[model samples]
Target chain A: MTEAHSQRPGVEIEFRSVTKTYPGQDTPAIDNLSLTVPAGDICCLVGPSGGGKTTAMKLVNRLIDFNEGEILIGGSGVRDVDITALRRDIGYVIQQVGLFPHMTIEANIGVVPRLLGWSADRIKARAVELLDLVRLDQNFAKRYPSQLSGGQQQRVGLARALAVDPPVMLMDEPFGALDPITRNEIQDEFLKLQNEIAKTVIFVTHDIDEAIKMGDRIAVLRQGGVLAQYGTADELLGSPADEYVADFVGADRGLKRLSLRLMRDLVKVSGENHAAPADAPTVKGSATLRTGLSVLFASGSRVLKVTHDDDSATVIGTVTLDQLQDAVYETAPKAPTDVVVAGEA
Target chain B: MSFPTQVIPNFSGPNCAGQFFCWDWVGANWFSVLQPALIQHIWISALAVLFGLVISIAAALYAVRNSWFEKGFSALATFLYTVPALAFFLLMVPITGLNVGTVLIGLTGYTLLLLFANTVTGLRAAPPETIAAADGMGLTRNQVLFKVQLPLALPSIMAGIRIAVVTVISLETVAAQVVQAGLGTPLFNAQRNVFTTGLITTGLLAIALALVADALVVQLQKLVTPWVQARR
Candidate 1:
């Protein structure tokens, strides 16, 4: 309970120097890693396979035990709580979906509720409501996992995890198995669902672009449970911590940063009513940095003013090649706003 | 019951007990001699098969849970089955001293070998995913035994029953040698009397009983496993 007050408003999870080592293993899967996830925020744990991202996420739910230190849910130590009771209060979604093949979608989603001893009628209603929330028709509740498409089955998996109305959600590559189009759709649907539910979520993924799009805070992990970097998407992209972080972001860091720097991040420098200069380039405010770069190239300017497409055009902001380069190549800044202003051309 | 005094020469042709007999005897005593033969044969075979199945299932389940016991049980069943039918009955005579109980014990022992092997194989064949799914559902061990593994292994277990039923029919004849009466005793006596037509009639009756019983088993299988049929 004392930890709850320390967690900023809406924060529900805290992991304190947790470590786990299996017998006969030379190195621990997670080695003294600590992180606090505030409530109502998407904190993505991103790293390549074998990194401790999944281990860190699982510790919050106590799916795996920690050898040292502790994990807390809503300020209570996970170790002190009963496992089944704890799991019922925290939602978990895996990449495989792990849907019960023999049960209908409704029964699958209602599993936690049934375990919690809810009345039969209430469980059924909740199952239907969850199905609808996931964008599936109520009629499909009776269908088995095989009857639903992979995306639909994954949606049902999410619904099942959310059935008990847990305050914390841990998702491990939830969309990793789907085709691109379906993955994007599920991600968008999840975001909408999260906005309404506002659960403190720890989402794990290896995809940097996905982390940028879906995470409010991204924790990049290295092998051996090392913390490569932990910051907002803009901070991570505009300023990686070291060569390891930069390399993990890959060689196309410039392009990756373009997607991370939203128009709002560069909005303060807009020169209102300023007539367009002959050498200046123009880009739509909504355009990504990659697209903005094309406009800058055609006009041969270092800076581009981003404007609304409406007839009564609104000046949103200005961006430059230096800011783009800073976001693409700079190290983790002590303060993100400082880099935003200093990096401006 | 001794078959109603066979009206010899009235049923079979002029020579009375010749090799090629007439159908007259079958029509005359169909309700008496034939009915008891059908009832007694069916009773012994059904009871033996059921007893064998119950024993096999318990043994198989125990084996599944303990690898150490499996080898010993497998050896025991094999040893019991190797004793020839007549020898098995003759061995039982001293213990039970000649009665239906002795006949049942001998047939039950003979059927165990077939049932035990099939049952072990069937339970082992249960899909790993099915077991994992049940575990994930939090079903208790007994629920898993009766609900998941038992139903999944039903077909293989049923095949074992079929094999046991056929074996019981043949073994029950040997069992009759230890008892005062059975379908086998009448045939055995007729062969000694050199009444060849009587031999032919009992042989035909046993074969007919086997055919009918096997057909009923097939029917029961279809009824029990409609899901398999639907899948096919």
Candidate 2:
């Protein structure tokens, strides 16, 4: 399975008993953190401040080297790789959008490739390709970062990171600086991009909602850089590892679990019962059961007419609150079969 | 060459129509007296600023991103500025006695604080995240400093150079007391002879030199930082 995954564009990232301690500080920033993110998944490292989530992500790119243990990307240890060559292959995006004020957007997007000595014509072509990939206008390539809106600058940031088409990405609160509306828009756009590119990613954030929305495997870090829980969003909301994990996930874990299941996924698992045509409060098939429940609760209706994502008015099926409740437990029962390498230490 | 007195022998006060700023006297003495002084002024200011800039760049690079070094170096540069210009020249006179060296040394000392502080500030003008991104994106240490930080720092560095150039031009006038160089020579000679037109003419020439240097630096700044102008 590991060999098969290595051949893919995205490769597995494993943190094996990784511990980091800063000089002049006795306490470890990240104490024996161990988890594995399968190919093409986002492993969100989330906790309160001082949790070492950022430190753990940095260890992957060797930005901040670890005092003990090892980090392996695609089965090879990170320490053996040449540092500059290693970094050039890792896409990095930060909250500042990483767009330096001096460079034009085209130059910014072409940075990594330029560092790799791509031909001038190739870099220019790559810049246009990336601007379009991140949904920016081609004319924006000539503008400086200061002329761009906060959201536009981050799009440029994303484009720059993807310039070399690296297999791994490290994003530290990349959208944390944007307003809520823009954050949601960029998050959705990024998810759509990730679907096509499939880069293994280590995303650091303090926000749990962002973690649950973004992570395929969520690693809930506790104080002192301890891993309290490592599992899918559904597993995290369904059965937290401890009281701290439960509290970290919040009181509305059940509703949060529902948010992870779309009506289309529900129809696939639960059969044609969801295919019945009925005059009910309509919800899109692509939306979460959470949205269906919102409609179910709003109009005092028990069932919702689920429409195709493209044709929203057509009713494919009607689902009740009870049906969604069953889905909360039924979805993705693959279970947490991961190594859980450090035992939450 | 005809002496100023011979050239303007019929003048009432070695002046132009009794005006303090006598244009006739200026025209008569320009090549023989004022023009040489103006050339000397440009040379002194240029050398002082050039030396100051090289030292400031070295100092700024040393002081960058370290608060302790920044504070200590800024304090030293500021102290250099606080030394009265006369005292500064007097101190230099003991080591490199009354000549262009004393004037150059004194004027260069006067520019250190402005140039050093602004260069240090310019080198840090690239935000922490931008620098971090540069590093994270596989830029070597030197590449980050040269390609990223230096380019971002151009406006601040140019501003420092502009002020330093103008300050050195102004200081070169006072330098005449210790060194027989720059516009200060003619102005001092005019003072000794009580020639009103010569005094005012020399003074205005120094001011014009400072203005032209400042404008030239500004244009140079605009040329180097086209990305900065895109914001406007």
Each candidate's chain A: what TM-score?
Answer: 0.85, 0.89
Best of the candidates, lDDT: 2
Query: What is the alpha-carbon RMSD of candidate 2 to the true structure?
Result: 5.1
Q: Tell me the spans in candidate 2 whose CA falls farther than 4 Å from its real position.
A: A1-8, A24-27, A272-279, A309-315, A329-345, B1-21, B65-80, B87-99
Give one digit per residue, the lDDT tens place, for model 2 in A1-345: 222222336789999999999999988999998899998888888998998888889999999999899999999999999999999999999998768788899998888888788999999988888888889999998999989999999999998988888889999999999999999999988887777788898999998898888888889988799999998777788778889988998999878877776776666555656543354688888787788888889988777777788998766666777888876665444344421111110
lDDT tens digits, residue span A268-331, model 1: 4333334446457667765666677777778788777777756315656667766666545555
**CAPRI verdict on model 1?**
incorrect
lDDT of each: 0.73, 0.82
Fraction of true contacts kept, per model?
0.00, 0.68
